[model samples]
Target: MNKAKILVVEDDRAIRNLITTTLETQDYQYHTAAKGSEALLEAVSFQPDVMLLDLGLPDMDGVSIIEKVRSWSALPIIVVSARSEDRDKIDALDAGADDYLTKPFSVDELLARLRVALRRARQDAGPAGSPEAVFTNGELTIDYAAGCTYLAGSEIHLTPIEYKLLCLLAKNVGKVLTHNYILRQVWGSALPGDTPSLRVFMATLRKKIEPVPAQPKYIQTHVGVGYRMLRIPEGGPAAPLGE
Candidate 1:
């Protein structure tokens, strides 16, 4: 495989130099940008495999950059920021950042997160003739690794959480996954108890797979209980865009 390309976007001269030297010493190809606009330009031209983005930029908010870039691309974005608020992390994730690291972080931690984010990004940009981790019913194909449904051979867009939930449901097939089970497994122990999020995610999944989202056919919600997938076919829907 070719060497991975990394973009380090930071306003601090000292930190930028430190990162540049570290990457160079390790023999990784890298680019540097102190502002969002320049970073964006370099992003498109440089074609980085992963981006280390600082939330506070001289030209624009880091969240804004993520939103704009995600409009056209799915490049892995890791937010390197001094902002430590949970809400800030959530905002970044919601804005399409794949991961977040607060400032004063260790280089080792950064490197570790880098591996994870890049792995996920590469998986998202799956290769041609990728193994079908799916079974179809009528018009839907479920990708196991990617966790998204395909309609008529076209890819369907889905939130990260929604994707996970989908994989859980699809993998089980006829097995019923209870509400608490889905919540605990997908949301983590940090978030305990009821999961309104699961409900919302189910609705989104139904919209993408069901011919009529209002009354889902694939994902059936068992009242006061959970959800189930009847029989997974070889693949999902066959649309223009592939999943």
Candidate 2:
């Protein structure tokens, strides 16, 4: 596989150096920008495979950069910021960031997240730029064309809403989907007091697909932000029929 190109957009000299050095250690091709304007220019000109963005840029807010880049490109954008609050993460994600890494993140974790984004990017750019007709992660399988889902090769029945939710997460696997984003996609809009209902539905959906709902291996809850569908490795035990 070709090493993914990365664009590092951080105004802090120290943090930029640190990230660039780490990328170098991994032999990754990278470019840097200290301001949002420069970041947008590089994003269009260089066309990096993935971007590491800092929410606080000298020229403009990082979320603005995300929205602009998203207008034309679907390349993975991972927000790396000091804004660890759930609201900040949600804002960046809603703006189209593929992932969010808090400022005090570990090098290992950052690299791991980058790899995941790259993998998703490659999968998205399927053979000759076509979207995959089916989605699979671990024991869960989604046949988009047939509108069916399976766990351990057993067809699992899902309500219309549950199926929609599962498909949404599967399509954006590895990327965080904020509550609002999910609501809009799954139910048409995020109505007031609907988040709580969404959570309840999610619980029932998990019970059907998770081997152990208490320790989910597929769908992950992000507290205030939203949910993410994890890409689990193949060969795991199948979802238990009964506890």
Candidate 3:
């Protein structure tokens, strides 16, 4: 099997060298970038399976890099930053980092996280043909093959994250998915304080898909548990809202 390629983005020379050495020792191929601009270029050229990013890049904030990359790709990003504050970690996760590691992390922990990220990435990969080629419930429709959503026969624009969240819930229709599970599946890793972020995304998604956001017919919340997608029956109306 081919070794997994990793792109390490850190401005500090010592830390960068250490990570590269560890990568080499682990028999992984890697490329290095000292700044965010270089990191983006390397990310494209190298097409790494995963990325180790530093939030304190000299050229740009690592959060910005995560956002930019997430806009176009689902590349797994494991943020390794010196910022240990919960707020900082949540910020990175919210910005789309798959995992977070504070500086002074153990090599073992880092490798374990990388393995988890890779495994999740592989599990989340879509099938050869579109697995969810098309999903429809009344006016709302999702065409996975075309990467588009439509409501009332008109195409609706959704941000990348919103689209992803919608697709996840849609794919598992009629089953209640806990908030933590949704966060981990959608945002990569679920942090303790990430519930509010999930709520915000869910609310935005509801507004787009539900005819009545307050009394949503499709997406239903399980009050203190999680959310569920009501599997609309063919040629029939959605079920009652309360779950």
Candidate 4:
């Protein structure tokens, strides 16, 4: 089996060395870059299976790198940064990061997240010779086989987590998926305290898929329970949960 390739983009030499050492110990084929511009070039040349990115690059912001890469590829990106602020994490995630880890993160946890990301990527790729599965409702469409989402004839960009959340709801349209259920299915685990993270991802997903996020016509909140993706009737108006 071919070892997975990883690209580590961190300006700090110490941190970069530590990450590369860990990757080497794990038997991963890896490359490193110390600047955003170099990272972009390496990403194209290396074509890594996954990436470890730092937000504080000298040439450009890591979020910008994420946005630029996401413009064409679905490569998994795990952000490793010292910025522990929620806004920073949200920004990176919204910009296309698959996961975020603050400075002084445990190597074990990082490896676990990397495994999860790789597994999700493989699942999303589906199996060879299998028929494509495409789900649609009015103007919203999800092409599971192609790993793409479209809203009103235009392709929509969704973060890894957002796309997973949307797929879960879209697959089970009209079913009220509890927070715990959605969290476990999309995130691989569910803790009572992780509800807020699930809510945040759901909000982001709605904003990308809903015509009016404030008055969401497709995804509806059940209030205190969970959310439901409304099943649009053919040539008819969307109905509420109980209707």
- Assess each prediction's global lDDT (C-alpha) against the native: 0.73, 0.88, 0.82, 0.80
The parts of candidate 4 lying over 4 Å away from their true place are: 129-243
The better candidate by TM-score, 2 or 4, is 2
Model 4 clash pairs are: none
Models 1 onward score TM values of 0.58, 0.94, 0.56, 0.57
lDDT (10s digit) by residue, model 4, range 148-228: 999878999999988888888776565455666777788788887999888888888888887788988898885555676
Best by lDDT: 2
Task: Tell how far residue 174 is off in model 2, in angstroms.
Answer: 0.4
Q: What is the lDDT of residue 9 in candidate 3?
A: 96
Taking the tens digit of each residue's C-alpha lDDT, what string does model 3 give over 144-230? 989999998999999999999999987765545667779889989989999998999899998988888998888988666577787
Could you tally the backbone clashes for each prediction? 29, 0, 0, 0
Q: Where does candidate 3 stray beyond 4 Å?
A: 129-243
Ranking by TM-score, best first? 2, 1, 4, 3
Q: Residue 147 deviation, candidate 1, in Å? A: 12
Per-residue lDDT value at 198 in model 3? 93
TM-score of 1: 0.58
lDDT per residue for candidate 1 within 2-34, as digits (tens), equals 388999999999888877887776667999999
Please report the candidate that would top TM-score against the real structure: 2
